[model samples]
Target: MARVSQAHLDARRRQILDGARRCFTRNGFHATSMQDVFKETGLSSGAVYRYFRGKNELIRAVAEEAFDRMRLAFESAGREAPLRPLDEVIDGVLTRALEEQARRAGTDRPGAFAELILQVWSETLRDESLAATLHALYDRMRVMWVVVVRTYQDAGHLRADVPADHVVRVLMALIQGFIVQRAVFKDVGGELSSGLRALLSPEADPHYRG
Candidate 1:
């Protein structure tokens, strides 16, 4: 048999995962089956199975992909350090996530990630291992954010009085709230960047020109 290229193998694996994402997006995690993935990929059962052992494995992969996007955003902010404003950094992450999610949605319907996240959360409730996996990803992201916040505090950009972890949590809460609101409600009027900036500090008003 001819040897397959690594790039080809990676592409095939991604194809399977992408198909699985669409299936899970359309049918919820529990409702989606290996057969569903097979249909989605238009490949033989053996081909899909070769990449993923079963539906559970596929679900884990899909969920990991979703979580990684958010994690990278946090890590990117951390790398930027004191140079980037906390609110702007966070808004950049949120904006990128929303844009990528909307593009992946392949539809005009807003809140695609919001709806998919709810489905993942429901699955996590039933699956302890999955829940643990998600928790680990979250904890890692939290640590990254805390470091970023502390860096800003040291630079006198953010208040040093508040605990770094506490500030990170509040900022995360705002992002989460934004995700939920943007996904559920169609018209989330007002500038999210300005709102997030104001949340970071009262002096965050964007309109001041002096």
Candidate 2:
């Protein structure tokens, strides 16, 4: 018997994960089964199970991979020397997310990634471990936002009086709302960057007296 190289093992694991993502995206979490994954990947039950104990573990792994990418996007944006404008940074991150989704789904549909996210969010309600994983990932992303908020405050771009955490919460809410809208409606007309600019800019809204 020949031993498998680490690269071979890694590729096999990725193949299983990619197949699982396709299954989950196509039929959703509850609808997809280990058998579906096996059929999709054309791998034996033993081969798939060797990498993942069960469907729940596979689901968790898939969700973690997606969220970790998001976390890394924010982490990279936060580290820029002269950080890009908030709206541009957000737009870039969203673009990257959609691109990744398109690559995974083998289509350029705008909501493919968003729909997968909705499924994960629904699954979290039933899976405590999944919920914890997502919560931790979100917390790390929120910290990145906090760092952004403080950076802007120090640079006099955002109001110094506003709590950083509060701003971070609103930012997260805006992104979440965008995802939900995109997933459900499939056409979220109007530019998110423009909306962010308007909301963040004191002079962009004339009717306000803040």
Candidate 3:
């Protein structure tokens, strides 16, 4: 038998992962079976099993790949000499996320990736291993956010009095809320950047009677 090159092997692995992502996006983590993955990839059960033991392993691989891309995005953004504005960073991330989701779903429709993330969140509720994987990834992401918050604080774009960690949590919440809204509602009117600016503004409305 002719030996397969490492490049070919890697491509095959990616093919399986892409197929699994589509399956999970469409049918969700719980409903997608290994057989479904096999059909999706046009690979035999043995071929799919060679890369993943089961659906859980495939799910882990898919989730990690998604998070890894996000980590890289944050790392890239942090490399700017003077970090970009918070709103710009958030908007860029959101745009990239939607584009990635569209590519994964093989459709231009919004929220495909958001729906996949929601499915993963639901799965984590019952799967301790998945939950741990996500928790560790989130912690690492939060560390990135801490760096971002401190940069903004140093630049006087954000309040220096507030704890960086607290700011990080709120930033994380904003992104999470964006994901939830996109996944459930599909049409989240208004730019996230605009909403963020309104919240962060120091001036109060004169019309408020409270």
Candidate RMSDs in order:
3.9, 2.2, 3.5
Displacement of the residue 43 alpha carbon in candidate 3, Å: 0.6
* Poorest stretch of ten by lDDT in candidate 3: 201-210
Measured against the true structure, the TM-scores of the candidates, in listed sequence, are: 0.85, 0.92, 0.91
lDDT of each: 0.78, 0.84, 0.81
Model 2 segments more than 4 A misplaced:
204-210
| Model 1, runs deviating above 4 Å | 108-110, 189-191, 202-210
| Candidates in descending lDDT order | 2, 3, 1
lDDT of 1: 0.78
Error of 2 at 114 (Å): 0.4
**Cα lDDT of model 1 by residue, 86-170, tens digit:** 7788878777776676556454444666667667777787888889999998899998888888898888777777799998888
lDDT of 2 by residue, 1-210 (tens): 999999999999999999998888788888999999999999999999999999999999999998898788777877762367777777678867866865786567758788889889999999999999999999989977798888877776666677999998998899888889888998874578888987877556465344
User: Cα deviation of 167 in candidate 2 (Å)?
Assistant: 0.4
Q: How high a TM-score does candidate 2 get?
A: 0.92
Which digits, one per residue and each the tens of the lDDT, describe model 3 over residues 1-210?
999999999999999999998888888887888889999999999998998999999998898888778777876776661456677777676768677766876767668887777788887988899999999999998898788778877776777777999988998888888988888999974568898877654344443332
Candidate maximizing TM-score: 2
